[model samples]
Target: DLDGDGDCEILYGSSDGKVYVMDHLGQELSGWPQSSKADLQGRYGFVVSPSVGDIDGDGALEIVCGTLAGHLYAWELDGSVISGFPQYVGRSAKSVCAVVDIDDADDAAEIIVHGGKSELWAMKGNGTALSGYPLELGGDEDEFDSWIFASSPIVLDLELDGSLQIAVGSTSGEVYVFNTDGSVVDGWPVATGDWVYSTVTPVDLDGDYEPEIVVASADGKVHAWNAAGEVVAGFPVTLDAPVYGSVAAADMTGDGANELVVASSSGAVYMINKDGNFMSGWPTSPSATTFASPIIIDVNNDGALDVVLGAQNSALQAWSRNGELILSQVHEAGDWIDGTAVASDIDKDGLVELVFGAYDGKVYVIDLDTPATDANLAWPAFRGDRVRGADAVSTDSDQDELPDAFEMAQFNGLEQSGADDFDLDGVSNANEWIAGTNAASASDFFSVQLSYLPGEPSASRRVRLTWNGVAGRCYTSWQCGQLDEGEEWELADPESGTIDCESTGEMSHEFDVSADDCFFRISVTR
Candidate 1:
């Protein structure tokens, strides 16, 4: 399930104190055989999704699960249960999950979960309790509050930190984040409006590896948050009332851009894409009572994104990535209906399958027979001219060897990581030439070319480029690649029609690097 392996491993915990593992087909891999017999398993159901990872580096991914019985279970891939349960620092039973090397060390990521009387807890890998004791993030200060944990915590690298951090949302309309060291990075009490019941989905729509947070608020509005927790862009729904039901974010378009799918209390489904402006163009929406979140799947096996919604008391609705309704499903034990749906290649056949939880306490598996997704495609957030809400730079801002994607913006088409340094020396070509040191001519160290971009209209009143002649040689070299900042010029290339040298003050000379890009004016040191 980790990497589209198409293996539907049963990642569930029983109150019986045992963690059970089965392939996507529901065959017993029996991860922790003895776990079934653990007295610590408690005699109830483990409602939380199984947190799977190999904390001991034994090459086997283990299960770290919590039970309503107030115990934490660590089950191994080979069906071997850890001897003792890690202390649940929280005062009450809640949810739990484990991440890998959160601190960037050989040690696995620490474990943390919420619930149980408004509290949070953190622990080191190998069951070592954190030194500062269990840390509580957001709990309903109001006891017996309608709910404590709105949804399972979503994890992403918010700080662009290689290490992943956890984002937890509360029924009180709060969003909180914490580092692996049990430190709170930022906490906002007004994150979402009342009843922001849905989990904050993290997706990088614009091809940025960093994911953006999307939350559905009871205010009947959906708000998109940047990594800093600022509300970037959002849309309000008129139907299904204002109570935000649930929200999911993903790139349904093979174009690398992501679309947002939101389910409302009125059972209405909505879809939107980040197209220059916020575009709400979902070709599909079921007017059923759909409170659960919709998951992105390749159901038709068309290799395109599909939408699947677990309806409330209604049949499950499946739509192709393009919004073509395909399936209307009914479950045998449909109670509250679909609780949560996440996609995975549980079968490990290179195709992703939909894995969702039902209020009936049973997990449903649906095969999405589509071809493996092309991970290389840019997500909605990673593409286009705008980000979150403002104008977005390209991933490669500088076209230098060092990409602008590292800067997380665009300078032309280069990404910070893929920015090209025309000088091949680290300085951006724009930076080198902007100061007007003449990036076009190398030896002169004082000449640069002014270029008109591709396809600029000449009807806007043409202006001619002019430069004084050099003191000596007519063909002296220019461009030092070390121009000061904020310098600019415009020159026309007679050959490319970019610069009509035939006009007055237009210097005429054969261009050394012409045709690829247009030129306006050339700086002459003489």
Candidate 2:
């Protein structure tokens, strides 16, 4: 497409370690070359993926590609090598990702790529890595074993524990889940009928706003698992044939529910709904086997989705949202297509284009160039945002019976649900709650250096501090001023402090505050 025109073009990179610039007709531009002049390498025997991000923050774009040679390369638009080019990943980085901050503190957005075996590494764009080496999900002490590691991991927001998790499928047919903080949650594994070959894809399969992961196994089955890793049904339903490519997720049937698009070695494309219900329609098989994956786009501005897939026969096909045969481009001159990827907005005209990788080690970009309108070129509908496990799930959005952190996340950042009670002083709010004389109103009750508490026996009471919200959170613990490496400020897990739960609502405990103004939070669970 002419950049000055409203039309668009596709841009892609390939397996031979070269990048391609193409015209709308899948025709090479006069100045285009099949291989990059940069002499970059990422040959992992056969694995590669190129990611697009404005690394230099320049208006122009950049490339971050991984290779079977276990190296990651970053290149600028001028075809010159960037300072961060060619970083090691132990051996072959199968996948690369940008870290989504789970703490929600707006930390730096570094790139995270997976090395072969069980290693996960976090690195800066310049390839400067954090202190720790790549960490393994399952240590040698863990009894669990993956059937064997072959599947590329799919990142998902499971655990709903605030952050998104890395969902990995092992050849052993076991699905392993880790917290966004990179720690193991509960141990529950899904036994796919066969080895998992594709990356894990998660969508709100049930449309409850919660997402479910779709894992395609080599045993010719696509299994669905919930956040807990339990097989939703007797999954492992047979697909048309054994799977090698990744399973695609998007609203394919035009229904509100998301559909699973599976591409097979037999070159068949099948669509199944959330319930694993297959559509009555199955498109005819293409002339060549499809090891390359499938992608979705709304090609005709119908507000519906279109399907696109690649084949080793050097064919790239696109189906209309309603399954109508629309566009096909075959490059007789190029090597067999090995991997396919799509990106939108190269021209920023609101429409995205198509890109694919070939065995010739060159990337190809072509204009999706369909009659897609702005309505048809919709971005991902699911824009998930929320990260932090400082508190358990906030069941009472109204700030009722939970901790201040629970209430903090919901309301403008404070709830007097009374979940935190560090002092056991009948009050369980936050640092905002403190009453030197009375322990009941932690929120409204600010602290006063207690000159005295009555030498004689005094009644136990709760001290409540007041913040704008009904509760307060985060306090510098006076009992344990500064925490050491292993120190934690916790009352008692099972014990409810010196006060008895059976003592009725009037029960309270008296604990001395610091001579200086110290911070603390209190909650009333009982």
Q: Which is the leading candidate under lDDT?
A: 2
Model 1 score (lDDT): 0.49
What's the count of clashing pairs in each model shown? 89, 48
Question: Positional deviation of 74 in candidate 2, in angstroms?
Answer: 3.5
Worst 10 residues of 2 by lDDT: 382-391
lDDT of each: 0.49, 0.50
User: Which parts of model 2 are misplaced by more than 4 Å?
Assistant: 1-12, 19-47, 53-62, 75-85, 96-107, 126-133, 137-155, 159-162, 187-189, 300-303, 320-335, 341-345, 348-352, 360-526
- Candidate 1 per-residue C-alpha lDDT over 12-63 given as tens digits, one digit per residue, 9 for 90 to 100: 5544454566666666663333442222423344645567665666555556
Shift of residue 216 alpha carbon in model 1, Å: 2.1
Model 1 weakest lDDT span, ten residues long: 381-390
Model 2 earns a TM-score of 0.59
